[model samples]
Target: MIHEIAPHVLDNQFKIQDPKPNDYCLVYNGSKSLLKKEGNGYALPTVAEIQKLGFEDFEGHYLLNIDERAFFLLAVAEDYAAPEGYEFTGNRAFRPMAPVERLGGATAAHIAHWEALNKFCGKCGNVTIRGEKERSIICPKCGNVVYPRISPVVIIAVRNGDKLLMAHNIDNPNPMLFLISGFVEVGESLEQAAHREVMEEAGVKIKNLKYFGSQPWPFSDSLIAGWTAELDGDDTIHMQAEELSEALWVKREDIPPYATDVSISCCLIENFRTGFTLPET
Candidate 1:
């Protein structure tokens, strides 16, 4: 959903291009992004402004090429202070902005996290360098290559007649309800993960597993594959106390308000509420 930027293209080719003055520069300190407040909103700085602020020494990666201009992600030192009239905010705050801005901010944050975690080779203790032909870091000594880490997760909406299953994650500080979701474990297919997550979290077996869709959730470097499944046996929910605080089924009229179009979880719930069926796979 967030990655579905129509009209505007996102080119992720690993080309060694210099930053132009007008190109967008995403400056990050730790996990927070720098944004200059403009009237009632915020805006990212240009390459020229970033250079003027003495952050030009930091190495930046080519994040995206959109509308003939490139976007670069720069990881600044934690001690770096924001210029006057600018403030640092977490990536979540960027979601309410325009589509291009929201996508750019998320992409920049993900790239920054990847770059910070892979400064040195995991196999050898030597420092790693960016790959010339691909989006990866290479180790000279051990020859180990590291790419951006994306953990695959399955988010499923369990259906039983006119009711949809939902749960509140115990680990989340926010009380927003969500569908059953979990990371895809080793040696498991997407469908298998979907079934396992539902059973683990809600203690229910699911049938008629249908592939819904997917979304690139950059908040924690996750690619969420969405699915819809029917209750196999019992309708009673045995909530996993460790993972979920509560679990319940809700009809279309009683479903709670949730996420925007930026997430596949929202799409899944909306589809079920509208009685829309996915095309045969």
Candidate 2:
């Protein structure tokens, strides 16, 4: 039995609230933190600096890390009360911030997506304005509506009894292997995406697709829909050079040293091999 990656854990806590004023928080671009405006220059504030500034009148959701040392704050566009040049730094830096960083990476990516895609109306090529009480942009001239876009992707752990299939991607920064995954293509269902990805990446067909769970991969604004599948039959393991660096089946007991908290690939294999899922609460 496969298991979830321990949602709602202390580190993955989703404490939803409204944005308030004076509440400084950390906003990350990949691994970098958004900086605070000091005089004409901007700088990363220490935790002590954030505590002194104060947070009030802000309302938003927040995701806190396990150690409680960091929190990811969220907010609407209207709640930002800063003067000019007080926006976030687009470059990568994860410096500390006041506990009020309202723009988590996922939320910031959504904001960027809205701004990038809503420049012109789809129907009339007119300008679009942000909607009230909702996270949408509307065009008054054409009445065309645009909402935040979420890319749904399938991530599957392909299994053949005690041995599971894992592959190394060419583009990943780390040299570790990853579970089979691909973005959901238009006109196809989630299962189709899983099948296509497995066959394309590992040259194996999978069946008995089972839905496991989901995670918000904010790094690229993707909603990862996870699943586990069984290989259709013994087949050749051919790697797609463009996508994967190597393709092979590894025993479940051999994966622990390579596991990371960032992905569900190892967790699924562990659950299947151990007969009990890891606890999260």
Candidate 3:
């Protein structure tokens, strides 16, 4: 199972006190900037300078919240370039690097996001400074607190033997099929959330519910809780047009090549496709 690197971890306790001057700080204009190693101190490139550089060679590293526990890593494209330059490649070469390298980008991105969002103190309407022992900013005036946010979501793959249930998103760009998935409601447990999503998205009840692993889905800061469920009644799928363009059963061999290959959804589906199962949850 995957859990996001909580932002609170980056609070003062986890920060590198003697960080190298050339350490990288992930910057964002529209996309993200190249991993710029820190110099003398943490220097955020000016917007003008970022504009001058255009968009290139950059990737999203991660997200940071004011609290130490609200952090997540992501890979974003730095598609900018400076004028008259040799067309910087940003960090495309490293965009799909190993998870370990990507981890650094995530940390930098999270911290940068936290710092940028905390420029002013909401409580005192005064200036805020980054706390040395935590990831939050301290207001010199009145004391109020802020933190990063995380949205929990469920992604499940419904299986009945060698066949799998899949759906095409009602609002997708391509006609790729996807598993039933959705966000958890305010007052729902993870299991309840999964069942609710399956029912709402596919109009089918599930049984033999088993908790699968998890993945840090940073596209919109989602923690994907993966699961496998047994289809109820007939294999016939009743599509929810508001939520899906189409829904159907597909044989494992007929599964289309994934559009976004790096997702827990794919992982869960593939596991079932290959007859792999974890210790029954």
Best by TM-score: 1
- Cα lDDT listed for each candidate: 0.84, 0.60, 0.58
Taking the tens digit of each residue's C-alpha lDDT, what string does model 3 give over 1-281? 22233432333234423212233334443344343333322223322343345423333222332332222322233454423422222333223543433444444444444455676887667887555555556886776666554578888889877789888887666567878888999989999998888888777888878888777654445667888889877666677889898888889888855423356777777787667778742
What TM-score, computed on C-alpha atoms, does each candidate reach? 0.92, 0.65, 0.66
lDDT of 1 by residue, 107-193 (tens): 878887788788899988899988988888899889999999999999999999999998888876667677899999999999999
TM-score of 1: 0.92
Clashes of 2: 30
Superior candidate under TM-score, 1 versus 2: 1
> How are the candidates ranked when ordered by lDDT, highest leading?
1, 2, 3
The best candidate by lDDT is 1
Cα error, residue 164 of model 3, in Å, equals: 0.9
Off by over 4 Å in 3: 1-13, 18-22, 30-98, 110-128, 137-140, 170-175, 256-261
The clash number for model 1 is 0
